[model samples]
Target: MLTDAQLLAAAARFGTPLYVYDAAELDAALARVRTAFTDTRLFYAMKANPNLTLLARMRAAGVGFECVSAGELARAVKVGAGGSDILVNGPAKSDEEYAEGARLGATFIVDRAEEVGLLPPRSRVLVRVNPALEVSTHDHLATGAGGSKFGVPLGGVPAVLNALRAAGHDGRGLHVHIGSAIRDATDFAAAFARLSELRPAVGELEVLDVGGGWSLDADLDGIADQARRAAQVFGAQLWAEPGRYLVAGAGVLLSQVVGLKATAHEFVLLDAGMTELIRPMLYGAVHPVLPLWPRSEAALHNTGTYDLAGPACESGDVLAREVPLPRPQRGDVLALLEAGAYGAAMSSNYLTRPRPAEVLWDGEWRVIRQRESVETIWAAET
Candidate 1:
């Protein structure tokens, strides 16, 4: 929701490879989800952009946190999230995760069956069940496929429940997360329908968490209705964990084009690439480019095809391919749209490159996270 002027202004002040988040967009996204799921409690999946500032904002907005690691749990705690406000989830959780999660009185989302044994006795829990259905997303993002490692198969839920009961744990209900960026609304219906079949043997429940994997433009009204109906059948409270959907569209990665090159493929080299935003390189994510020029709209009419290459040494360092943009110069700034979620959260110091700074645009530009310093990159080393 930021104008080109605001984006360019942030880039100019904060430097290239900067992340700019629109506060209005964030509020709008939360409002949409709340409106659609009027009765359901919404949790923000912290893995999608867990900047402390952002987490604090979400917490202030009365959004709960879904943490998958010790660090994320600590972040939630730092932001004053209580046990009831946190849902600890992850496959192969670490000892620290269990210990911290237990100490904080957070609900554990049991991933595998054996995880039940590791939980604190009589702990509140929700067993994650894999629907094992195909969804419209990248192969790596498909957690519900038959062979996926995310959750126990659909057939294994009853046994896990029995185990939870045997272990003296308070297993409230069930949890099912198909995958990320699921484009099909029918996927939710089919998956939920399949899950509903287990209601007979599973019996009445205390909660039914229909995990979130909705696309930015997914039909929330339809999805929320399906989820609510499933929860109603179980006579339980509905819960959801929306990760990327809440934050992806609110962000833009500001990268300066270093230059153009003519090689085996035409390339527009950028300072920000795999290190800054790896979603594109990781999963063929297509981030549209917007050149910061008064005549940019006109320039799109006169375009050229090129790969938006990054400074990474690998040949697969291209962020986007066959991108059509006006010829870019060495100092041209380009805004990569929809780089918010999984953008800064997944960035790394690969090749000793420092991660970019992040700024929030509420009304005025506010520095949320300063760019990582060079000395701090290796300060942890001996």
Candidate 2:
């Protein structure tokens, strides 16, 4: 947990529009997961936050990694994760990625039958099964339901398994990722029960990868209980790939209030925008926003509804709407909570604005990533 002083100091030291991650919070998250899902293989889904420092910390904590690309796999290895400790998963994998995964001995979570042919013979693999069951979550985050572009449909699982067997790949397990930000335990239990039903069709499974999507607000005990049930029913090793659940609440994005706009609705314009944190614009997501420091009790209590707008030119660049906060003046710093996952990882050079710096604070603050400069942004331009 970062204090106002630490956040304020980070803003002062690194300038506004900075990402601050607390390593202690990350460790605590891992501890919570381990405590809840004891003995279950925990893989840190690198897509959520691929900061090298964070990867290193996770690796050191004896956590495996789930990578979606060769680059992510390489990052996992660079951070000290063994080849056997990584699982490669994605809807579309290139020949190069297959080659890399094969060379590194990383398990492949085959989403399509064609991907099975791309892997090395007798390679370790998990067939991603789309149970067509929808979890209670944002539609965009749902992956296992029918009409989804992600995993193999339920009806097609047997064919895909036969394809893997024919290809001589060791189809060790079944993987189900219904959706992300899943808060319901019944969803997990249902997904597992559904996958367990396929046991006869697949025959003698060795692993049940109840894929990542657990939300920070989800019932950990309920999820673990369901996972235990799945493991017992399938008589296989249980595994999970947790991304946002492990990191979303461990970070904060700091931005300085640049000015107040008097529009049809009052707006508090901040230096940070979609370029720094785009979840709000991307998913209509709401992140708790609060002033880092208040002048007095009155300043804290003098609240008004305002639209937290970003510096981005697009009208959709607003961070939050109808936000009730103390009257903010110019230079007031604001903190966006639950920004650890996908904050910096999903940021881009949109509008030619450089991505903000990222700092990791365990005990001492260290700049894990320097703020991108204009030259860095255009360095690849021919």
Give the winner by lDDT.
1
What's the CA error at residue 234 for candidate 1, in Å? 0.9
What 10-residue stretch in candidate 2 is worst by lDDT? 113-122
> Number of the top candidate by TM-score?
1
In Å, residue 283's CA in model 1 sits off its true spot by 1.4
Worst 10 residues of 1 by lDDT: 293-302
Candidate 2: tens digits of C-alpha lDDT, residues 146-201: 88888887778888888887888887878888888877878888888887787677
Q: Compute each candidate's TM-score over C-alphas.
A: 0.98, 0.97
Cα distance off (Å), candidate 2, residue 233: 1.4
Going through the candidates in the order shown, the clash numbers are 0, 0
State, as a TM-score between 0 and 1, how close model 1 is to the true structure. Answer: 0.98
Tens digits of per-residue lDDT, candidate 1, 236-275, equal 9999999999999999999998988998888999999899
Q: What is each predicted model's overall lDDT from 0 to 1?
A: 0.90, 0.87
Off by over 4 Å in 1: 296-301
